[model samples]
Target: MATVIHPTAIVEPGAQLGADCEIMAYAVVTKHCVLGDRVAVHPFAVIGGDPQYLKFDRASATGVTVGAGTVLREHVTINRSIYPGKATAIGENCFFMSGSHAAHDCEVGNHVVLANAALLAGHVGVGDHTFFGGGAAVHQFCRIGESVMVAGHASITRDVPHFTMVAERDDVIGFNAVGLRRRGFARAAIAELKTAFHEVYFTPGNIRDVAAARRAAGAFDSAEAKRFLDFFAGGKRGFARARRAEAEAGE
Candidate 1:
């Protein structure tokens, strides 16, 4: 299939566009941008802009790469990485709704959805199948896990574990049960995840230490449970804590 670039759109020299890409009117794909097959850049969207860093050198030969089948809507901006040969990468089949922004050096995984006005700060890492609701904003360098749901207008300042739901101010409400179901997770797996979630969050001292101990003790059998536990192993920003009242009520 042929790629289409609107007459008014600007795809600068050195930009790489795969087949079937549609660059809408007034969209700007800079020289360092690379877009994969079937990628759609909506009107007024900008990719490969320089990083927002104060100390960034404009001469850094960085890039922004959008993977296959990704849709970047109007007014969306994905900034290039700050280091040479590095890229701000958006993975395959991801959707960024209008006005969403992904700052410099972000590593976004496949099948992610960023709703309107959702913002990912510089150097943030997001795992696959995650959903950020409208107006949600993740802090810089935070690691958000796979299949997590970040509620609308939430301010996430810490790492969120896999399959959890975060809302308001860094509050981990609970496991993302509905999302797990929609993703075709087995009932047994969901149940195991629930147990692991409770054990790790409720009985926790230092959350990372608790999760590591549980993992070492072989307390969880299911892959879902293991993944949930493993997520706590890293991230310097610390994990989002579950609300005490909600945890007490077992919500």
Candidate 2:
């Protein structure tokens, strides 16, 4: 299939576009930018522009690279690196909805979906198959794990674990049961995840205490349980704690 570029679009020299790409009107593909096969650049979307870094040097060359089959919707802005010569990348099969923004130096993984108005700060790392709901924002340098689902309007200042459903401000309500179900997780697996979830959040003891109990009680043997534990253990900004009021009310 032939690539299609609107008359009003400007694809700068040295930009590499793969087969079947479509660059819509008013879209700009800057120098050194690379777009993979079947990538779609919607109207008014800007790719491979100068980074928004304060220390950016105009003389230095840098660019953005979009992976295969990725779609950049209308009004999306993806910036390139600012540090002399570097690259900001979006992985294969990713989708950025309208008005979404991916700042410089960020790495987005395969099959990730950023809903409309979702914003990623500079240097953030989004894991594969993750889904960010509309208006969700991740702080700079935050790491989001695979298969995670962030609720709409959620503000994440820290790392989010794999397969978790996080919502509200500073709280992880529960596992992503619905997401897992849709992804074909078995009933036994969901049951194990539920048990691990209770141990991690609803237990009477601290996180460490609950983790230790899980290990001793054979809960850590399951793959899902292991992921849950390892995620919290590796947390830098610390995972959200269960609400004290809810815990007390349950008691």
Candidate 3:
């Protein structure tokens, strides 16, 4: 299938458009951008724009790579990376709703959904199959885990664990129970995650310490639980916490 670019769309020289890509009216695909097969860039959407950072050099060799079948809605903007030899990448089959933005150097995994006006700050890492509600805002460099659901307008400042639901105050409110069910996760798997959440996140102590104790006690019984444990162990932004009596007591 031939790629279609509307007459009003500006696909600059050196931009790579894969087979069957549809670049709509007034959309801009910058010179360094690469769009994979069947990508639909809606009207007024902009891809591979210059980084917003002050220190970024315009002459630096960097761009955006949008994976196959991704849809960029109207007015959505995905910026290129800030450094040379880098690219801000969006994974395959993701749906970016209108007015959403993914900032420079961010890496978003496949099948993620960013609702209208959801925003990800620079260098944020998002895992697969996560859903960000409308107007939810992630702080710069935060890591969001897979299968997570961020509630609308929530403020996320720290790393969110897999299959978790983040709501008010950026707290890890609970497991993404409805999402898990909708995704056909086994009943046992969902139960295991709930137990892990209580032990690792809701325990009235230092979350890491509680996670360690659960590991020592073999409290994590399933492979899903093990992955949950590993996420916290390797997390960079640290885990999001709710108001806990133990933490307040120590303070």
Best candidate according to TM-score = 1
Off by over 4 Å in 1: 247-251
**In what order do the candidates fall by lDDT, top score first?**
1, 3, 2
Each prediction's TM-score versus the true structure = 0.97, 0.85, 0.92
RMSD of 3: 3.8
Q: Which parts of model 3 are misplaced by more than 4 Å?
A: 216-218, 243-251
Candidate 2 deviation (Cα RMSD): 3.3
In the predicted model 3, the residue pairs found to clash are: none
lDDT of 3: 0.88
Candidate 3 residue-wise lDDT, 127-217, digit = tens: 9999999999999989899899888999999998888888766777767778888888888988888778766766687777777778778
Candidate 2 lDDT, 199-224, residue by residue in tens: 67777866766776676667555687
Highest lDDT: give the candidate number.
1
Q: What pairs collide in candidate 1?
A: none
Candidate 1 vs candidate 2, lDDT winner: 1
